[model samples]
Target chain A: MKSPFIAVSKSEFILYLREPSAFFFTLVFPLLMMLLFASMWGNDPFPGEEYGYVDFSVPAFMGLVMATSFIMSLTTSMAAYREKGVLKRFRAAPATPSSILIGQLSAVFAITVAGVILLLIAGIVFYDLRFLGNFFEFVFAFLLSAGSIAALGFIPASLAPTARSGVVIANIMYFPMLFLSGAALPWFMLPDLMKKISLVFPLTHAIKLMQGVWLGGHFWDYPVHLAVLTGFVFAGLFVSVRYFRWE
Target chain B: MTDNVVTVRNLVKHYKDVKAVDGISFSVKRGEIFGIVGPNGAGKTTTIDCIAGMHRAYSGSIDVLGLDPVSDSIALKRRIGLQQQESEIPDRLRLREAMELFSSFYKKALDWKMLLEQLNLWEKKDSFYSALSGGQKKRLFVAMALIGDPEIVFLDEFTSGLDPQARISIWKLVGNLRDQGRTVVLSTHYMDEAERLCDRVAIVDHGKLAALDSPSDLIAAHGGHTRVYFDASEGFDGKSLSLLEGVESFVNRGDACTLEVNARSAIVEIVKTLDVMGQGLDSFRIEAPTLEDVFLNITGRQVRD
Candidate 1:
């Protein structure tokens, strides 16, 4: 049997595709960061390695893109829709709230997938980056990371009273996650206490998992990172479902 | 088929310290345009919200088409269409896309092409929601509600922002819905709209059911007197006018004289009294009993805002 929620998902996807701001922030901005950083510090390598900042910055930039697209964009848009009575309008019909949430999450997931693919292509062509890990393991980690971040985004979306407040709440969590989770700055550079605090954020674990898979670390080596990201997916889903509001 | 499409008994709702709906009871028959009319804080919208299953945790029973609106919401939703007081589609969603997507939620939906044509929205099918005018957005909402071809339709503040022409067009469409055997439940504070369009009206005030009847019936029952007012002139006597058989009161405001008469047609009696007294009025007009007057008589206050 065909699930009716799929129709809503398709419609949401089309609407997202038509939004120019979404395209710029999700797809274009990440590649631009990679290019700009490569120009600034591409030649400087670590003490014993030939690879420069571009090699490390490219993967961190992927985490940044996921954080922006999945966490920031999804939370802001959903909360805005709720604030504008779009969710109430849907509730007036026969559509269920869970279906609407799934529809929105699927659209965000699809956009993240497309954005990551494009980023990977640019990484390989422009910076001569390669996937040292097994292709299937990288695929699994990438999808799990996106799912975790996307789910975590709904927490702020559900709690916010209005769209503007939703953006503010998301940014409150977003900037800290970006800087501390090795997206804007590497984890090794952070002080010991900051590193401990960063571990509490899902993005920190997500970036660790992504970097592990991208740089050939075996799946068995990062059990804690995998568990933490999976925990975010579960926790986010629980809170979002419990406090979901149609209006 | 049952005659009553909606039945609300002792319905009560509260918002923190405010009692928004206080034990209002009413029933709406199938194929009738039943109106819930009241002032801004009068709970008309709250009643509709309770009936539509948009509101929950109320104290009483609300049955719509033999289904409990809150518990059987999924089944109830498919059978009823709701045009909420404040609802908007996504800003970038085009008209046709919205219609198509909403129609998919129902088992029986009207043809989008025919619905668009009927609402005069065909020409603007490709327009984004943000680009449409206010009236057009309202029409689109109406179309989305009707697309389900549901047995009952609830429209809250349906014509609040519409121009006169658009309002009339919508009235015609509502009449068409009744002709097609669909029950309509409308909430509005407009007395003229209630008087003109409702088969029966429930006048709500201060979170209670003040009165419920046909517009004319309510007017005839509680609407006290027809007031005749004219400029206070030299020949008019307030004392004599107050002594007339059906005259309730005669107030002389220096600039104007208002004679409140019990009879519906007060002009003939007023002219007769004037002739007998050898008096003439300048610029006289009779104010007949309206739904507003009925509300005023029952609540002892004007419905403001």
Candidate 2:
């Protein structure tokens, strides 16, 4: 028997492939992002060592891809589907509505995993960035980041009326998180007040977790990021479920 | 009770201040092609919407296959198929894919290839929904509504903007549904169509049912006047037939004069007068009243003012 979830998941993946720009952003852009941001923070930005920016930013780029593909991409596409009565049609059918939703998530899930794998290879080969802490922290952080971003995607999906507006809403959400979460740049150079505000966003927590993993920072730092990301995951998922308009 | 497949009682639906369906009641018999005919905003759509479990009427009881659409919605919905007015299905799906997707909902489904052949959509099997023409889209919709093998189907304005040939093809398709013992509740504004296909019709206007019955019965009751055409035996002007009992209007056409008699009583009087005079009658035929006349009789000659 065919798994029902695979029906929607495979269909969504196939359709998304037809859009060249979305495919590039979800799959290829993360690598470019890793290179550009890694180069900017200094070819070797780690203190007391020669861990290149490629090494430092690779981990951050993993987290960044999770946010863009899982949260931003999922939310925008879902909003467009809602605007076009796609959700409405599913509601009428006894077919797998939830499976279709999960299918859309699966597309993001695959994209994020691919980006993570590429980042891992680049970090190993070029940057020589070692995993100094428990593998579980890195793994746990990866899952949480993906879930948190997926949940947060609901907010923009709820507010954006059309696909175009969804793009704008995502940009409004992403740019600030990119700059402040230390994904685009580190917060160490900012004044204390600016650094304090950055702490509020999940990006800060994602960054802090990865930064801790590299230096083997105390596990205590890991929980704070996890806690923030966990809280956001619940809130974003809840609001998205409550307000998602299917046309 | 056995004869009826659907029964709606005291159906009253209100939206804000306006009553969309006001205290209407009707029943559709099993395996019959029932039509509800009305103009735009005539409450036919609202009435069907309530019956489809899509809307909650303010005060009404709609029972389809002995189940209330609102209260027993899931059970009722599973059995009834609906085609929304101007409903746009999504793109990014093949014609066959759409059929497969919707058919997955039901325990028993019509065969996709069989349905495609019926709609003439088989050759366009690989085409996406957006690539289909308007008639093709309508045919696809009809196909989708039937794919689930619904016992009773509700179609709202099924063929509003189609070329004449497509319209006739759809009417034939609707006829086939009744032949297979499936009940269909159709709503359309086309009078000639309602007359041709409806086993029974509910004529609605201003949110109330103006008349309801078989085509012939409705004509017998409210269809008033049987028009007759005959030569007013020479030397007798059509003017000589002025103000006769049943004759509502008279016009002389060269040798033949047409008379619009008000009732069967007027026809008897006209026949007696013409026969007693012993004048040469050129030609004569009694024209039965149509649904349009019933509409005018009920709504008045003003045409929906």
Candidate 3:
């Protein structure tokens, strides 16, 4: 009768540390891509220095890292465990239900923090951006953005019957959110249709909120992003918990 | 009621159209190695789960150590030790850490190091669960179930699919448990395991109780008669031995004769009568009944069916 939360935490950390490939995918890989994109897009081509291309894309790219670390990672891991009968064993263990989930959340969230730090460091050194907002807003933005996408994650987590299915469903969101949210492609340069399409995805609001906090903009708009993201976490938690099958 | 460590009254469990427990009832005495024998889906695992407070029965009452398993699970769980069907430990956790984590749950615990050594898994202490072989995993599970030094131990399919050597090792370990004064309740399909280990056994099928008694007693009660076979001399006629005392029927084929003997000392008398008839045999053998025969007689189906 051990606490499942502790089991999950210990297990996740052991898995993360034991596999070098996971480190790259979860930490080094995402950060490397963020750097690669920023390097390719940093200097605006053939123009008077309007909004810096690097400056604009940096925030969006950082948003993608958060989405991948918490949202994509959780959905994939949780779904695989469910399909493999790992979750069912958790239910019968000495650990309570709450601890199991909290353990998973903590592991994913810890990775999210590492990704966020890498993004911030790259943004400052490469883009020459100021820390316009206090530490509080930065923390809030990270939590809020993670909350929204992680909520959306449960959608795939519940539906996927196998690990492959989980990965496929996660990609369906990964491409749309990263590209349309102006994380990779500039939202301003995209066609009017693309702008409208971006509005449909929560990542757009997420990146926008991050931008607002980055620029130290109006607080009223910030709460909208936070609220929407919070709502997503709650909705996802309800669905995944109900439909999740352990083998 | 007296000296009963585990009791069930009219237990019923069903899933859609199939009844898993079938309103069965039986009890296990304190400090005894009780066994349940049946094929898969005979409600063995389901019954143990209900008794362990993991699954709620559709109806009927189950009391383990005089406490309701379903209603008072927390208190019961702390006292009881369990080895759940299939593997319950996660693949990622290491064996050394697993013992420590499980041991933390109880106020008093057996020495994890000693138990690991006893299970021959001391070297595997640092090995993660996913990497262990099936037998290693089974031993680890058995070790964990004894961590709390529980008064009543529940083991489902305790020894199945194991080599004869491994099975014997586990059987010896189980015997040691009884020597230490802990009650063990297990379900197995292997008749040899039941006959050699259990103090009492309950036979179940299609979610219904078929028979319950000590292995020898059940065999004696249901076993029809002792069968003796031998090679007869030339010109042997079964008709002449038909009138022999306690001989139900006599059959012969060329140089072989088979006598179906009845009552106490039937085999001894049959041999003596055959000797008097000058029926010198190439080989003579007594075919006594085993638990398997009794199971077949009670259920009209094989043990694994």
Candidate 4:
């Protein structure tokens, strides 16, 4: 027989695909944002930068994909499952709680990776995007950024008691992070106070690390961002495991 | 060696201010269909939850297959199957997928394809869970519970929402489980289900076990009296039935007469009495005491919420 982890992960991945809203937010929405932003700001090079606007925007959009896949999609699904008693049913089986958690995480991570690949494809096809960074460094930074956000998602997933409240909690955190973190808007365009506030959000650091690494910089270049994101990953995991309710 | 597969001692559970299961005790023998029957909020489900290790009791001890349910929960889960009262699968999940996913959770699993077919879900294997009817969904959960090929199965309100035909089929399926030497513990509010399916029935009321015995024993002890009704003849004296042997009480409603008899043999005396009275015994019917009467006798006839 197949392992519980594989069985659960496969079912969750299939369920994610069948969910129209999750598919829209994770894949379609990101590509649409890329098209809209690229058209508005034209792909011309920034004042002092060699790369065009689309080049930097593509990497930053990867942060948006992580946020949506983890915060909005993953959190809501987990809470909904709890509300419907699916989690309680799973608990009655022989599978451990860790198996369910890791299985769900793997599925959401796969979706986030797919979303990132789609953005990359769109950038290359539509705007002739450039990449001067080391492929290994970019991949490493991408994984860290996505993993941190995915881990943080469990906080809201464990706290929300119902699916509707899960959406409310996710949206409460999602919109502000989207605008301030340079995911839906550029960081340089933000006012000084807003920029200061944006630094408090994990997505801001994610965008910084992803943009830096994608533009020929090593991950070690952003020590503060790396430390902040790593802290969030551990804290999120701790809280979720501590407070998670099966029913 | 004892054949008892489950034993509960002074089991007590409370939800904040509400007492869900209060000092309930019982034992389930192996290869028998044991039932916990009660009205809504009677703690039937709560007791099952405690024994199944789904809920930790506020106080008390539970041993299933000689393992403590609270401490040996994981090990107990491996050998027991549970179909919860208010649990559901993801709406988008297909029937086949749900089966396979649950089947993989056990060390040894029955063939999911055969289970699905036996449950009449093979044709709808690809149907989304939300698309199935309520009865089908119940059957699907039952199938998932059995896919692990567990030694013991706990079904809470297993056939509550099922139609008559569906309920009968599921009852037969449960009977087969016991015949195959698996201990089956089910909770239900349907008195007929308990009387027909269970080898022994536990009557619960207000979070306490009111009575526990076989269906026949319970019926004989507390099922009240058998009622015999017959159409009344014009100018017939109703006072005559009160004098008949074994007739505990008699009521006349002008058009009909009803006699509460203490024994089944009273029916023969009733017929002879009516014949002697020249009523000709027309429109005669006998209502035997059932488990429902047993419940009403022990728990009172007041409607429960």
Candidate 5:
């Protein structure tokens, strides 16, 4: 007999594949953005910079991918399940609340990894993207960044009363984060006022940590970014477990 | 040991200012199909929700299979199954996959493939949920509920939106569950369903249980009079027919006569008298008292939403 976690995760993974909007955003949308930016900015490295435009943007785009997959996709799916009474059915069964949460997180993380891998391949093949960072450090930074954002997803997932409202809340947060977090536009291009405000967004810290590690810098070199992301991880999970509703 | 599998004492639940369930009490015996029947918003679903532990009552005590529904919810959930009134599966989920997924959520489970076959859904195992018709979707939920081999099953508004043919098919599936010695608690607004399928019926109105008893007993006590109508011949005396035993009253309207009787034997006596009168009866029909009549009698004739 399969464990409930495994069963639920496998079911959720299949459901993720079946949702067209989630598939397009997580896997297809990021690559399209990468191509558009690489073509527009020309892959040549900037003055005194070791990497080209695509190389710098690839890690930042990964942050955007995490936001879409976790903040948008995961929240909407969980809210829709609650609205449809699917969660109620699961609760009536032997499946625990932890099992459902872990299953959803696992599925969203798997899709985020797939999206990131696709973006990386596009950059390395078409734009000659550089990878100067240590592989293990980069992996650690990626996991921490993605895990924190995915945990943060549960806040909207728990608070949204319906799937339609979940989409509204996600978009309200997503569009602002995309423009302010340096995930779409580079950090240096922003004015000092915008940069100061961007520090308040969790996605900003995620991109800072990811970009730092991808550019051959140690993760511990950015203590504040590390702490902020770690704090979000704990706070998000705490709020979700404390208040998540099954129906 | 007591045969009662479920017992509720003064179950009261409130939704803010409105009382959803007001001091309702009932016990369900083992291996019987018990029904909670009422109009829309009469708190039938709310009562089931309380017993299933889906919602906590404002003030009440409930015991299901020797466990409190609130404190021992997880254990009670494992021993019982629920089919909610408005729950749905993902449209993209295949029938076979859904059965398999739900099957893993229990310690002991029936063969899901066999359950599908029993529910007449084996041929559509690979079909997505969106592809099934309304009746088929209802049957699939029942199959999912039974996959865990629960000792008790709660089905809320089991056939609320089904066509007549579909309703009958679902009724047979429910009968099979009762035959397996599993206690079945169901709620429906269709009185005929309660009259035919339920061993005992609890009629609820305005969040209160108006009456609870076997269908026949309720019909006998509060179902009012059974009317026998026939086209009366010219020169027939309605007063003579009214004097017959068990006939409570006689009324003549246009060319027809109606005999209100308190017992089934009164119909035979009236028939014999009509034959002896040589009135040559034509076009006769009987309106027997049913659960609907009992409901109207107890709950008043006001229409409910």
Candidate 6:
């Protein structure tokens, strides 16, 4: 007998693989960003610099991968499932909503991890970047951050009545977070107001954790950032459970 | 064990001011095919939703096999299969994949291959949902509903838009469920479907129970008049036709005359009356009352309208 969680996750993974748009966002888009940013700014910023911006930008792109794969993708798919009556059908079946959500979030986590690994490899092979931190610690923080962001995705999914509405809600958070949370730029380059504004988004702490792990910084140094990300996880998950509509 | 598979007492559901299911009560017996027939907005779907634990009735006591539908929904779901009116699978999902996904939800599921074959969809198992025709899609839903080997199945408007061939195939499948001793609760406005498949039907009108009985009994009780039509091969007195023993009224449509008669043996009386009038009956048609007639009689409106 197969566990319902695994069964649902496996099918969700297959569905994620089958969608061309999921392919574009999860794997192709992030890889292109890595290649684009690495080639365009190959050399470092200073006069005597030898390394390009890719060395600094690669970890942020990993954060980008998590957001696209979990937040954007999960929100749109969940809303679409609700709209198509898939969620209601499952409710009528022996499946529990918790199992479905777990399976879906786990699938999203797995796919986003795969995309991140590929991005890291591309950065190493093309731009000569290397992980400077403990591998186990990096993996743990990466997954936790990804799970938190995926929970954030579920909030909009539970609230939106349709896929179009879900996209609208996701984009309102997604583009702004991508720009302000250091995924599209280095954190030090942001103006004071923008940096302060980014503090309110979960993506900011996610990027910070990823960058800290990549740069060999002490994992326990930023307890406040960890707490903020963890807060998002609890809050997002609660809201999703409270508002989800099976029909 | 109780013989009744489902029971609803004083069921009422309100959405703001509209009473979707107002003061309705019915019971479905074990191992029988029960149907709910009503026009659109007549509360058929609302009633089923409440029974299926999808909605909470404002005032009601609903029991399915001795369990409250809402409070014991988890257990109820394990025993009952539901094919909702508007439910659909993902367009990109293949038929086989969908069956596998749904089967995994249960502790012990029916074999997917067997279900596919039973639904006559084995060859299309590998086809994506978007690739299947509308009838095939409906069959796939039926297959999914039965995948868990549920004790009871609820099919809402199961054959609404299918062709005659497809409708007959589904009707046969539903009949098979009854033969296997599984209770089925069907809600549809198709009187012919209810007439053919249901052991008993509850006719609902304007959110209330208008009548409930075996289809034949209801037809016998409420299907008041038979319709008779005859071509006017010769000139006939229209007012004199109304005075015939069984004739309730007569309509003269120039070349033909239509008679609404109150008695089943009115056809014999109509022919005799035509014979005594010295008119040649070039063509005559006698139509017996059907479930549709019963429904029209009770509701005073067509099911579709």
Better structure of 4 and 6 per DockQ: 4
Task: State the lDDT of candidate 1 residue by residue for A186-227, as single tens digits.
Answer: 787999999999998888888888787767787678999889
Specify the highest-lDDT model's number: 4
lDDT of 4 by residue, B1-305 (tens): 88899999899999989999889999999998999999989998889888888875469888899998888888899899998889899999999999989988988999999998999999999999999999999998899888889899999999987899999999999999998889999999999999999999999998999999999999999988999988887877877778878889998888788889997887888788778877866599999889998888887763233
lDDT at position B101, candidate 4: 94
lDDT of 3 by residue, A145-169 (tens): 7777776776676667887888788
True-vs-predicted CA distance for residue B273, candidate 5, Å: 1.4
Q: How high is the TM-score of chain A in model 2?
A: 0.87
Residue pairs in candidate 1 whose N, alpha carbon or C atoms collide under 3 angstroms? none
At residue B58, candidate 2 shows an lDDT of 55
Model 3, first chain, TM-score of 0.84
lDDT of 2 by residue, A8-117 (tens): 66666766776677778766777777766655553554578645566666667777787788667876787777777666555444443345556678877887888788
Tell me how many clashing residue pairs each candidate has: 0, 1, 2, 0, 0, 0
CA lDDT, every prediction?
0.84, 0.76, 0.76, 0.89, 0.88, 0.85
For model 5 the TM-score comes to 0.95
Give all TM-scores, in the order shown: 0.89, 0.83, 0.86, 0.95, 0.95, 0.92
What candidate 5 gets wrong by more than 4 Å, as runs, is: A43-46, B302-305
Worst 10-residue lDDT window for candidate 1 chain B reads B232-241
**Native A-B interface contacts kept, per candidate:** 0.67, 0.15, 0.17, 0.74, 0.59, 0.65
Candidate 1: where is the Cα deviation over 4 Å?
A1-4, A40-57, B226-287
Error of 2 at A150 (Å): 1.9
Clashes of 4: 0
Best of the two (3, 6) by TM-score: 6
Best by DockQ: 4
Residue range B114-231, candidate 6, lDDT tens digits: 9899889999999989999888988988898898888889998889888899999999999999888889999999998999999999999999999999998998899877888888
DockQ of each: 0.50, 0.32, 0.27, 0.75, 0.68, 0.64
Cα misplacement distance, residue B183 of candidate 6 (Å)? 0.7
* B229-299: candidate 2 lDDT, tens digit per residue: 88665567665465677689988877778888877788777777777667555576789888878888887
Error of 4 at B278 (Å): 4.6
